[model samples]
Target: MKVFTALEAKNRFGKVIDAAQREPVTVTRQGRPSVVIVSAEEYERRQSRAWRNLLAVMEQTGRYAAEQGLTEEALDQLLADES
Candidate 1:
């Protein structure tokens, strides 16, 4: 990964794009990391994997809730108590 300050990223935008195509680039603002620039292929791949992971977690959560006999009303009551 390559790191660039906000000004460097803006002034040398071409280099940033080039670096991002080769690997991820970290852009910082106020000396703190703000965002990452990644190739479109990598971004799409990560997004797809994240979606699959989220779906799997959701499925498991629902299955566990069913096994625990948790109903919508019970879940609502629990949420209300938290507030």
Candidate 2:
């Protein structure tokens, strides 16, 4: 990853975008990490993996809830609390 200050990244926006195509670029604000710019392909890959992981977790939770005989309203409340 390449680190760039927020001002530097703004001044050299094109370079930051170009670098992101090759690998992730870290943009910082006030010396703190603010965001990471990644290529479209990498972003899509990460999004897909996250979706899959969420589904797996939901499946496991559903199994556990089933074993506990959780009612629909209780499950809905549990999910609402998580949100």
Candidate 3:
């Protein structure tokens, strides 16, 4: 990842976007990291993977709850709460 100050990123927005296509870029303000710039495709790919992980965890938890004799209604409630 490449770090850039907010002003520099603003001044060279096109270059920053171009760099983000290959790798994420960190944008900072007052020397503190604030935001990340990344390609849209990369961002969506990450989001999809995250959702898959979350679903796997949820499935495991639901199985455990079922083994513990939780009712269907209660399991549905638990899943809803997690969401």
Top model by TM-score, which number?
3
Q: Rate the local accuracy (lDDT) of all candidates.
A: 0.98, 0.96, 0.95
- As a TM-score, model 1 comes out at 0.73
Which parts of model 2 are misplaced by more than 4 Å? 71-83
Model 2 agreement with the true structure over 25-81: per-residue lDDT tens digits: 999999999999999999999999999999999999989978999989987898999
| Model 3 clashing residue pairs (backbone) | none
lDDT of 3 at 20: 97
- Provide TM-scores for the models: 0.73, 0.73, 0.84
Winning model by lDDT: 1
**lDDT tens digits, residue span 1-83, model 1:** 89999999999999999999999999999999999999999999999999999999999999999899999999999999999
lDDT of 3 by residue, 2-66 (tens): 98999999999999999999999999999999999899999999999999999999999989978
